[model samples]
Target: MEIITINYPLQGLEDKGPIRPKTLAIGHFDGVHKGHQSVIRRAVDVARAEGLEAAVMTFHPHPKEVLGRGSEYTTCLTPLEDKLERFRSLRVDIVYVVTFNLTFAAVSPAAFVDEMLRPLQVKRAVVGFDFSFGAKGAGRAETLRELAGSDMKVDIIEPLMMDGDKVSSTLVREALAGGRPETAEQLLGVPFSLRGTVVKGEGRGRTIGYPTANIQLAGAYVTPRLGVYAVMAELSDGERYSGVLNVGVKPTFHDSLPMPVMEVHLFDYEGDLYGSTVRISFISFLRSEKKFASVQELIEQIGADALKARSVLSAFK
Candidate 1:
């Protein structure tokens, strides 16, 4: 799929001379969660039915993050790279990644439609029912439909519900924060994961006989709850490994730090992974992070955790 980055005004930015007439799916799909996928799927299906290209329009540096919202909106579930991969998997023909800054945030609804959507030759748009845009979000789904009028068609998808609650990015984040990756997987149609680079740590895991690779997250990703979890790690070379991951400070030997560190012990593997990149997918919440009375006690618990993690992760592989 082709990716086009658009600055404010969104004119004369395409590599090709003219943008194709397409059915566009518009949203800042952070995690490409189930609800977001539904919107994209509708656009693809509509485009196929009407014989138009399937395109997606997403924003970078989430509006809330750029607008100085609360800290909760600071970190993202899926970074730009992960998000684009999901779009590609959905079979989107093109992706317009509009840069979201203070200037773009000031655009009005009518001006946005006339300057961006119409110029791009959008034949139809698929949006969520609660989607809003323009300065301070003055435009809603109905507003977009009203502005489109006869020139373009609009379809507003309702919220997707699983079990009882509505499936959304916020809902997925909430589940992760609460140490429920299983719940997030249900809402996302797969496991939630983060990409990162493996860095050198204090060679402590090796001394304990359970060597681990310290991981530094690639982007501003929301760290899961402070605990140990069963995980599946994929190296940059595309090799996968089942593992036990810890997201916490080593309280037994050191003082509590400001941020929790991430490290993983890949089962039955022993080769240098330092400086290599890996994507870790959380599979199960094993237990909360705690300080053991002694190093032996901690090691014993870890052995038990590894046994439990192996049992749980076997099903995933």
Candidate 2:
């Protein structure tokens, strides 16, 4: 797949000379969940039927951040790079990553269609029912159809519902935040995961005879609630191991830490994993984090947690 980063004025697109017409799937597509997959697949189907290339148009830095409409700590379900990887996996022919800034946000709906969409040779556009664009979100699906006129086609996918709830990024985030990864997975069609690099810790886990790999998360991902969870960790070398993960401050040992830590203890595994990147998939929430009076009590509880995690993971095998 080809990735094109475009700024406001849409420069350098013509440098490649004449380009093929594209059927574009347009949205922020933060999580690239099932609902997003439907939109992209629709574009691909249209492209195949019309003999056009399937392309995806997404934005970076999030519009809410630039418009000051979101909190400072607002994060993405899947970061930009991860989202692009998902698009690639879906076999998209082209990906247009538009930079979202003040100037770009101010583009009028008509100008956006005339200068951006039409110039890119977009023959068909597939978007979700709730998608909106243009300055102050004045562009709706109907507006897009009107702007496209007879030259292009616009398809709006209705909301995808599951278990009486719409499948959406907001629901995914809420599930993760509430420590209900199973629910998130059901909505996403995949386990909720976090990727991070192993970092040095206080060596407290080793002292307690349960060595752990402390992870430093790579991006601003939505974190699960503070608790112990049954998980599977995939190391950089492509090896996967069942594990028990802890997300919290070590209340038994320290008064407090700079931030909450993600520590995973791989069941029956021993190796030097420091400096390696690992992706941990949440399987189930085991227990909430709590303070213990003594280190021995913590160790005993961890043993119980490990046993329960192993039991939970046994079904997967």
lDDT of 2 by residue, 1-317 (tens): 98889988888988766778999999999889999999999998888887899999999888898899967336887888778878998889999999999999999989889989988999999889998999999999889988899999999999999989999988998898899999999887789887889999888889899999999998988878999999999899899899999999888777898878899999978889989999999999999999998888999999999999999999865
Clashes of each: 0, 0
Please list the C-alpha lDDT of all candidates, in the order they appear: 0.93, 0.91
Which stretches of model 2 miss by more than 4 angstroms? 16-18
Deviation from native of the Cα of residue 166 in model 1, angstroms: 1.2
Worst 10 residues of 1 by lDDT: 10-19
Assess candidate 2 and give its lDDT.
0.91
For candidate 1, the per-residue lDDT at 35 reads 98
Give residue 315's lDDT in candidate 2 (0 to 100).
82
TM-scores, one per candidate: 0.98, 0.96
Using lDDT as the measure, the top candidate is 1
Task: Score residue 277 of candidate 2 by CA lDDT.
Answer: 92
